[model samples]
Structure formats: C-alpha cells, structure tokens
Target: MTDEFAPTRFSHVKAGENGWRSDGLRDFFLYRDLGVAEATEGKVICHLVKANMAPEKGTGWHRHEAHFQIVIMTKGWARFMYGDQDTLVSAGDCVHQRPGIVHYLYDYSPDMEYLEIVSPADFKTVEMPAPAEVPPFTPWS
Candidate 1:
C-alpha cells in the first residue's frame, strides 16, 4: 500500500453497544472499517457510533496507545473529560485526543449522541494497561 489508503464510507445511523454495556444504556455501533485489515498501513482506523444518553450517566475514563481518537457529536450534548480539563461538546462539535491520553466523559445530557474515529488504523492492536474497572465505560482517571 502506498502513502494513501482507500476511503471507507460511513452513514449515520442508530446502533447498540457491544460486548460491554454501561449504565443500563442501550448503545449503538454504527460502522467501522480499517482498510479491510490487510490494506491498512500507516492509515487511520475509522469508527462510527450512535447512541443516546438517558439521564445523568456518562462514559468512564479510558486510555489508548498508538491511536488518536476524534469524537464528533452530531446531536445532543456531552461533557468530555481529558486529563484535568472538562469541555462540553454539543451537536456539530468535535473532540480530538492524542495517543496515551487519559480521558473520559461526564454529565452527558439525556439526548447525547456521538461518533468516535481513531487514527493509525492499528487501534485494535492497543492493549488496555488494566481491565477497565467499569464495564461498558472504561475510565483511566
């Protein structure tokens, strides 16, 4: 593969959380593609998730290695916690984070929804330093 990688198409849709569920939340996983695995090289791994927050619950802190995550809130509102800072992200707003950063979400509105994208394609290769104490939501802080 050259420096350029094939683009994957993603359509906004509703989905449910996988493996682990949080706060009695029925989450969703919209779409994901990492260049069909073999074709991915030095490229970004794209993921799209759609879910709604019911009340005062939020995702837990989590850390990533070799991946930069960019969360785009298409609808609703949410408060993102990265390190010592907390930022409220609403519809049409996006949050980006570098690798190995400790981050989490708090005070998610009842109608919060977002899409998370990871760069470097090899995101799956990252190993969690420790099993996230909280299921569904993993908090590093």
Candidate 2:
C-alpha cells in the first residue's frame, strides 16, 4: 500500500462506549468521538452527534474549512438550507457536504442523531451571512 494510503490501526467502539460532550459547532448538540481521530492521527475524525438541549435559534449559516465531510442521519430528521436549496435529511440518509459549502440546520426532530465524518481531526468553521433569507427556526422540545 502507498504511504499516503497507510494501513490504519484497528478501532472498535460500541454504541455506548464513550461519553457524550458538547460539540464545538453547537452547544445544543452533544458529540461522541468514535476514536477515528486518534486512530488516523488527525487525518480523519468520526463522531456521533445528537440533540441535547433545544435552542431557540438553530445553527445559522456556516461552513467548515476541511477537505471533506459527510453526515449520516441515524435517528429522526432534520431540515437544512444547503446553499439556495432546502434539504430534509431523515434517518438512514447520508449527505456529503462539499468543502466550504455554506449550510444552515434550521429544524430537527427531538430524537435527531447523526454520524459525522470529516478529514483532519481539527477543523475550522466560518460563520457567514445567509445567501438567502432563512426560514423561522422551530424549537425542538
């Protein structure tokens, strides 16, 4: 195998193996790292995130500074504004967020949960003004 495509170490994580903590992206969403960050040595990071505390205002328009990112909804559903398009992501739905694509997650069900995988364990988020008028946020109970 090429050095760039190195053989990653073995990693086995149970669903409840790790504890959840507040995510840097949003305080209302809790995150649990799946050990991919350490296993890959900052090359990639995988984590499970779920709704913890409902916020009056949801995640506004923002973009992540990374090479790649993807989200797989594990439970419930969420509505997001991807550029000029409004997308509804439900359980089992997977979405690949292109680099630097601005998006706003405006609404979600109470049981919202997802698995996010991104390249580079440490990434940056840039908040930007909405390209279009955002819809009213519906609070999650």
Model number with the top lDDT: 2
Q: Which stretches in model 2 have alpha-carbon errors above 4 Å?
A: none
Q: What are the lDDT scores of the predictions, listed in order?
A: 0.53, 0.88
Overall local distance difference test of candidate 1: 0.53
Candidate 2 global lDDT: 0.88
User: Which of the numbered candidates is closest to the native, going by highest TM-score?
Assistant: 2
Cα TM-score of candidate 2:
0.92
lDDT of 1 by residue, 95-126 (tens): 77777877665555545557666666556432
- Candidate 1's TM-score: 0.55
Clashes (backbone N, CA, C under 3 Å), per candidate, total: 7, 0
- The per-prediction CA RMSD against the true structure, in angstroms, equals 8.0, 1.5
Question: Candidate 2 at 70: error in angstroms?
Answer: 0.7
Q: After superposition, how far is residue 111 of candidate 1 from its true place, in Å?
A: 2.6
lDDT of 2 at 57: 76
Displacement of residue 49 (Cα, Å) in model 2 is: 0.6
